[model samples]
Structure formats: structure tokens, C-alpha cells
Target: MSADTSAEWFDPDTTTFGDRLAGARELAGMTQEELAKRLGVKEKTMDDWENDVRDPRAMRLSMLAGLLNVSLLWLLTGEGDGPGDPGVATSYVRGGIQLMEEIREISVQMKLNAERLVRVEQELNELLRADDAGAA
Candidate 1:
């Protein structure tokens, strides 16, 4: 993952509330079990929240934001101050970029293949039409 100057890389607008929560938690160097223990919630509950299956109540959300060193608004809406820098390594960033590029390439290839399949199907239909006409 090379350094990307695009706001898409870190823009809150592109992320969901759960994404913000998980990112903040990771930046705080806390695991789901650890955070759950601190919050007096079950690990499954934490997982559900992080996975966007459920949301925390107002008070618990506030506490979670504070514990993760993020603003409640940011955690909820990604509008305010977010988590502090987690000191992500350049190599990791580069790797992520590479993986994203690879995925994009694969997507393009898949689209092309789909298009080719459609064209083949159309040709086969045309051939069948011609064969029927000849038989008639």
C-alpha cells in the first residue's frame, strides 16, 4: 500500500458507523474481548455492534467513544474528531494499495468476461435462428 493522498483513504464520509467504531478500537490497540470486558458487555455484543448487526445505547456509545479516544459524533456519524493516529506503517499501507489494485483489476476482467459471455449467447441465438429458417 503506497501513500494515497486521496481523502477516500481516510475520509469519514466513505465509512459507516461500524467502520468508524472498528477503526477507532483498532487504533486504541484494544481487542473486541478486552473492550467488551471494559464495557461490561459480552464479546458477542461487541462483535454485533462492530459488524453493524446492532448499536449501543446512548450512554454506552458515549463511553465507548471516550474509551476509544474518539468523539461520540465521530463514532456515530464520522463528522467530528476521529481516533488518534495509529502509526500505520508505510509497508502495510503499500500492501493495502496493492491489494486494492489487484481487486480492481479482477473486477475489470470479470466484467469483460461477462460481456464476452453475453456476446456469445447472442451469436448462438442468431445461429439458431438461421438454422431454423433453413429447416423451414
Candidate 2:
């Protein structure tokens, strides 16, 4: 008899579509820009999809799965032939996946904070200009 290994596989409940898409892209060795170009989409669009800001339509989704060499079901639900489990131990893969998820979360937070900073800077600049105008 063999051991049950479901616990060691990628868990869909804990991962988002963006996470799966990004992982597949990385495993396929294609940059977001390259994948976007191949799909005839803007790089920003790809980023939006991978960042969970947007999702692609069926056609684009199919193309993405094809390009990334993953099943569409797996891409959407993480339940099919996604990435192969290499010779590495399953526990190690699980740990690595968890780390990647954490890093992704941090990166998203940083992006949001950077956007907020840009808006704050713009507001400050406007205030400064208004003050200078009032002085004049």
C-alpha cells in the first residue's frame, strides 16, 4: 500500500487564481511580458491578471493554460496536471509553496503602499502649489 499524498499537493482552497497563474508562468520559464505579448495583451494586463486585479476571458484563459503547459482545470482549480512533482520531497515543495505565497502577499502589499504614496505625494504637491498661489 502507498501513502495518501493529497496533503502534500497544491491546495486550491488556500491559493488564488493569480497564485496558480504566476506559478505556472514561472515554471514555464516565461516572463509576464513575454506571455502577454504571445497572448496579444498588454504587459500591464498580464500583471493585473497575475495580481488578481482582473481575470481573462475564456479565450485568453485557454491560451494561457496552453502556453503554460497546464490543464485548464488545474489552472483554475489546481486539481489536474499542473507542474510535475520533481524528485524533491513533498514536504519541501509544500514549504516552498507556502513561502512563495507569503512573498506574493508581501509584494502585493508593497505595490498598494507604493500607489498610496504616489497619491499622497500628488496631494502634497497640489497643496504646496495652492499655498504658493495664495502667497502670491
Candidate 3:
């Protein structure tokens, strides 16, 4: 995900509307101070919203989406391709879905590979022990 927030991963099209707002805020290099200035909100208020400490009211959500230059639909539902670019949005959603499946598949494969490595290491240890015993 983008280094815009505390979250290790954030997909605007996949996260809740509020999360998308936070993510976009981060991407734009907006500090709570700067954002607050632009948004006419108190710093604590911005902080709470970003951390999910508080939910943005409906009117606030509309303002946030506009301020962040993202689509309201994407911000809220993780649906639609993106804000205004339908083609880009479609590609983004498709890629996000595909990437999730690929990551899961790789995780399973890696687990299997790790198991094989453990077995091989065990065999090598046994072989080394046999050599040492023979020498003794």
C-alpha cells in the first residue's frame, strides 16, 4: 500500500470510504495541520477520523472525497473502478482481486517449500551425525 498512513496496506477501492479518505490524505503528504487548514476541521478531529477513532459524518464524507480528489463511491464502498476514470477504476479493481488470489497461492506454495526445506535439513543433519559416529 501507499506510505500515506499507518496501515501497511490500503486499497482505496477495497477499503471502507473513511479509510480511503485517510489513505488519500496520506498520499497527498497532508499532515493533520495542513489537512485541517484545507478542510476547516480541528486537528484532533482529523486525527480521530484517520485512526478510525471517529467516523466522518455523511456531509463530511462528501467533503473528504472532494478534498482528496477521489470518487465518493470508491471512498465508501471499495466499488467502482476509481473516482472518475471508469477504465482505470475497472483495471484497478480487477488487479486488486487478482493480486489477492495470487498472494494466497504464493503463501501456500511457500509453506510447502518451507516444509521441504525442513525435511532436507533433517536429512543433512542425520548424514553429518553418521559421519561423526563413524570417525569416532
User: Which one is best on lDDT?
Assistant: 2
Please list all clashing residue pairs in model 3, or write none if there are none.
Answer: 13-78, 17-75, 81-89
For residues 1-136, could you state the per-residue lDDT of candidate 2 as single tens digits?
0135333435678778887887677656678999888776899999999889999977677667667767789988888978555222211123344345445655766899999999999999999999999999
Please report the TM-score between candidate 2 and the true structure: 0.55
Best of the two (2, 3) by TM-score: 2
Query: Candidates ranked by TM-score, best first?
Result: 1, 2, 3
What C-alpha lDDT do the candidate models reach, one value each?
A: 0.70, 0.71, 0.61
lDDT, candidate 2, equals 0.71
Ranked candidates (lDDT, high to low): 2, 1, 3
Error of 2 at 69 (Å): 0.6
Candidate 2 segments exceeding 4 Å error: 1-10, 86-136
Record all residue pairs in model 1 with backbone atoms less than 3 Å apart, i.e. clashing.
1-93, 1-94, 1-95, 2-94
Q: Decide which is better by TM-score, 1 or 2.
A: 1
Angstrom error of the Cα, residue 102, model 1: value is 45
